[model samples]
Target: MRGVSADGDAGLGIDLLDAIEALKSVGCAVQAVITDGVATSIREDRRARGLPRAEWVRGIASQIALARRESPNRGGRHLGFAQALVHEMPHTLAMLRTGRLNEWRATLLVRETACLSAADRGIVDRRLCSDPAILDGVGDRGLIARAKALAVELDAAAVVARHRKAVSERRVTTRPAPDSMAYLSVLMPVEQAVCLQATLGRDADSLIATGDSCGRTRNQLMVDLLFDRGTGASVASGVPVAVNLVLSDETLLAGGHEAAQLQGLGPIPAAIARQLVADAVDNDTETSLQRVYSCPQSGALTAMESQARTFPKSLRQLIDLRDRTCRTPWCDAPIRHHDHIRLRRESGATTADNGSGLCEACNYAKEAPGWTARPVHNPGRTHLIDVRTPTG
Candidate 1:
């Protein structure tokens, strides 16, 4: 029979689907063969020639990266899977070669059996991978459950030891995000995580019941309280943690639904912004306001000017508010410097039009070889800048 056409023509729908599935099966078989070859080469080279593991892996990854146009991490993952299939899980390799098991499924077997010794892993591979029909209706979650049960049954002590080791490595990490926001990640015991979540929920409910007109949502209140407690800010003592907000007079006074920009954070309900302002003003908390004008069409700000020419503190604050985060494309790092898009020595004006925010890494990356940056003033878009790299 003639194969399906490249475009959506010249075959029945079922036939086209069958052809696609056949191609995918062939591709999996091909992958298994290639991986086996690579694994064999690595083993032979490492044993007979005595290459170090690190150097050999780097060499393999470099070759794979150049050939496949993939990152070294991806190459390393492929090699890892290859090594597992060749040495630890021959039955898995057979299933993969016969197109009965996909890469993800085989990888799952490898990952779930990681706590097992090589001999135990081989036992598991033999049991599960011997017959494809046994897993006919099993999904990823089901497979994981079945595999985990088998592993724990096989080596209960090993599972307990692995769990105890993982508990010792628990930690909290912070990652920056767009709009002056950051993510706080906690890797802890399951019970501890649940307790932390429940605590946040209880405090949020209590705060919401207090009945301020602030219109802060439950999630918002939880976040605020977490920050408040973490930073040791006292709401009762009138030393609440600072939250910056930008609001217009019309939205604040007239109760308009126009969203307000929370500094470093993105947009929030105008009502919430108004309530924050009212609470701060009523409590006599330290607050500052600036009048910012915007271009009507693009909604970008007009230049904020200063006569001192060294870039005043007010100007720095203005740039921070305008850009919110690093101006480099795809970079969400918090703004660390108020920089001239066109270099100061290159006759760039010390106005908002020429100023942008950049994090330390990106700001210095601009000074690297073959990098150029400058502001491009479109009539409607006043706060536009362009950055170029060596490649471009």
Candidate 2:
């Protein structure tokens, strides 16, 4: 593998293709192991506890998540894919095992056939994957379109039902982006999403035609219009929203070069923070400042304590500021739950030191058996948590 990098371009291309095929084989082997493990565990649980299948499967995904070093949501999806390939889609699995189809393409096949019955799904899988050469030139979209068409032909009613269920799952979400920007995404029905985009474009075009766009490009004007309409703030005027900007006294008062943290987003330049504050003031927007003192050396916020079991709003905010995101290692999801590092039933006090910010899924996954989290002391000005998973 290392020598492949030193090869000529033609040789390198061949080596790369071989490497990818090898990876696909490895992925297929891993899926087989996961499927076997799940089956074995379920059988053992049923025999030992005489429990229902649903009860036996509880917390299994959490164990898989720990073993795979992924979030529980991803673990569940993996488990589902493994089951589908092992039991229902044998043709697709065979193609994957032989490296004719990669894991992602196999997953797409499964997803597109999700609305079909087992028999119907098998037919689609066989039609699409039985001859490995048939998929040689097929792209992702082409494979998905073929599988979807087959699924619809097999069971149009099931496809319509799946669409209805998917519509119910539509939601809006946000994620941090590069350069202190953030991506705001909406998952809506296709027609509604298209109409919203068309509306924004039409308005932006009208503004451009009227020469009132203040030299902004059409795309820029469309984005600005979205912001103004969403927040009820005029673009020509300052923003009226209450944005939390966490900065040091040195940065805010003495022109220090340190970056400022924006809540729900990440860090921004100190200059931009100051300009935002100045704009708010100039526009006479109502603004209030609450002092948050941190250690000069370590930059850790001062600890706050409470006797109540539930964390107070102020303490929750402090934890949010301290952690910035989910505390689970490798999971950068935004904090949706203020979790107790130590359980309250075990005498964990509602104090800043014992509090941690976590995403909702991670918080729930931690409640499974054999998962433990505790605060550990560190000499540096940073909060340290020791988490032990069942596999560990």
Candidate 3:
């Protein structure tokens, strides 16, 4: 049986390699389709009226997103990569077609050389990827480092411009994780990020040296210090800002085991929610409770109304709580707009049933021609919306 197992394992390894080669072939075909589709869209737009070529190209990404089952933003990136590979980085694309390079490594090459002009990019691509042997043992980071060095040699000014542009785009974001935890990410310039980490490490070491570190590990101490410094709360568990905790009366009052939601985050254990409330009370933190009326059986938020066209702040908060994030399909961006599912001018009321939470981009996209959205009714579900894109 052991000998048979070894033979089976060898066959499985061969099959896995074949599968990878097939995936590489599919990736090449997908890129070809994307570039050809862009050309076709531009030619068709030239024959049409009113719509600019750029606007027509915008819709192409959405259509590609639908076909690929991806977000519109990711579809746009895919289109950009396809255009670069087909028009500028032919050597890298050819290597991808030959299965010498995978999609991710090819994307790294394209990204690292993005600051270079087309001619310079072509030069880098030819030097790095012209022969399969050039990348035989190189890993992702090694490939990126080599590509960056070539790009700097070809045009250092463009690299400087790219760094400046990237610095301007620094931001902080959060996402939920498993085990009732969440990740907070800061996207800053490399120097700033490195400095921040070093500062945290230094502080954590000093705390450990003081011999009152409370048995926490170095990484844990760094995290706690980060929280305390960011919030100025002295203690990591102290609440320095408003935190909206949504829990049912049964869960809060009785010993019900239902999950509760923390706004901007996702579901947490009911026990943890009660613990947070208890801690707030014990610490004498100023807290306020607002009643959020919901159907007892279905847990859907009760409808709130306004006579005005625009949503009021309270109603907007309700919509935000109800939706938790953008209502667009597959787009979980934090809600930035309280939208009327049906246009207000088209007889849509300013009420909870008619309102939805959408990110800024999704809200603007919905306003474009041929895009439509409406409320969906499901007896036991929370707020639901049906959105139809132009392609649909």
Question: How much is the lDDT of residue 154 in candidate 2?
Answer: 91
TM-score of every model versus the real structure: 0.52, 0.92, 0.90
List clash counts for every candidate, in order. Answer: 1, 0, 0
How high is the CA lDDT of each candidate model?
Answer: 0.73, 0.83, 0.81
- Candidate closest to the true structure, highest TM-score: 2
Single out the weakest 10-residue window by summed lDDT for candidate 1.
Answer: 57-66
lDDT string, candidate 2, 106-132, tens digits? 889889988888899999988888898
| Per-residue lDDT value at 273 in model 2 | 89
Q: List clashing residue pairs in candidate 3.
A: none
Top-scoring candidate (lDDT): 2
Off by over 4 Å in 3: 1-7, 21-25, 35-43, 52-54, 378-380
TM-score for predicted model 3 compared with the true structure? 0.90
Q: What is the C-alpha lDDT profile of model 1 across 104-140, one tens digit per residue?
A: 8878888888899889888888888778887777899
Error of 2 at 113 (Å): 1.8
